[model samples]
Target: MTQTEAAPVTAAPVDAETYAQIVQFYSHHMQLLDNAEAEEWADGFTEDGVFAQNVKPEPTRGRDTIAASMRRGVDRLKGRDVVRRHWLSMVVADRVDADSVRTKYYAVVFETPAGGKASVYLSTTGEDTLVREDGRWRIRHRLINHDGA
Candidate 1:
């Protein structure tokens, strides 16, 4: 008798309720950033959260540091007349455990100058680890891998 290999088993997908919650969380997250609400954006993270980008070698640790970093970016754009928007697509969430989830999504950043058409500024894929803190889903870590970077 010949032995046959078994097909790979995949993890169960997130339920619709969980998926909707995550979507709402992400929507609020992006809106805060787009509106330059740095502190509020940071509040979406845990106290010891991490944020990293492909271009940066070091990750920003802690919510305070993350908020400051976001503020700095907002400051740079203050006088530039540029409106930045983050578009997320193809978000897939997997349950890591009872109170934690891992998500992968595609992110596209668009920039529209005053009186100008919006154009894609950056495109990247992101992996995020989210944990339930204080009965709300908060980002524990986020790693953004820029396309071609």
Candidate 2:
């Protein structure tokens, strides 16, 4: 007898309203990060959310910790006249439940220094688990996998 592996299960298609809400969520998230609104960006997550990167072994958990980390990064760039933008594309979302969604998207981080042309600083893929809390979609867990990693 031979053993065979089963195929992965795909999520069901979401309704128009759910799809629109997800798109808006991503847009607002990107906007907050690009504008260096660390606190606001962190607020997009649940109280006990987790943010992990492929390059790092440990994940950042909780809103306070997440906000602090973002603030530190912002402080490090305080003296530099650099503009950072997060461009997200190829977004695919799966509904986990009526109030939860799982999504994956491609991300490109572009940086423009002073008057210089914009260049790609990082390219990565992100997997996020979002849940509706208090009538808003908030990220419960996010994993960022860097390109070529």
Candidate 3:
């Protein structure tokens, strides 16, 4: 093998119980954001978690910054009396290590204004790094790519 090419690492697949827990974790995590519980949603991340979107120039790093960003979006939507719902599906996870997993999922967000019909607001696919911390799953990093972008 060439020195430049790295060898693959062997790791066990995430167990059934652990995989189920991860799925459940995403249910609550996405709901928190959809409900505009910015602070609470951010609490699901590690202290140095990162959030990145393809449309954005740079990823937002740190739990505090991520919370602040969510708060702003929540406030803006609330001002317009718009409610957002996130529908996440097609979750696939691969174990990176005993404590970390890489997840890929599809998310579609629908928004409804106070007096308007619901419409699709955004469609994206995301890959994230999740870590088991203190007996719970927390996002270590997230990378989202807009379906159109």
Highest-lDDT candidate: 1
Q: Which candidate do you rate higher for lDDT, 2 or 3?
A: 3
Q: In angstroms, how far off is 15's CA in candidate 2?
A: 1.5
Task: Give the lDDT of residue 89 in candidate 3.
Answer: 81
| Comparing 1 and 3 on lDDT, the stronger one | 1
> On residues 11-101, what C-alpha lDDT tens digit does candidate 3 reach at each position?
3447789879988998898899988999999988899999999999999999999999999998888888888898878877878778988
| Candidate 1, residue 139: how far the Cα is off, in Å | 0.5
Clashes counted in candidate 2 amount to 0
Provide the lDDT at 41 for model 1: 93
Q: How many clashing residue pairs, candidate 3?
A: 0
Pairs that collide in candidate 1 are none
50-112 per-residue lDDT for model 2 (tens digits): 999999989999999999999898777767989988888787887778898888889999999
For model 3, give the RMSD to the true fold: 3.1
Candidate numbers, best TM-score first, in rank order: 1, 2, 3
Q: Which ten residues in a row have the lowest lDDT in candidate 1?
A: 1-10
Error of 1 at 108 (Å): 0.3
Poorly placed runs, candidate 3 (over 4 Å): 1-13
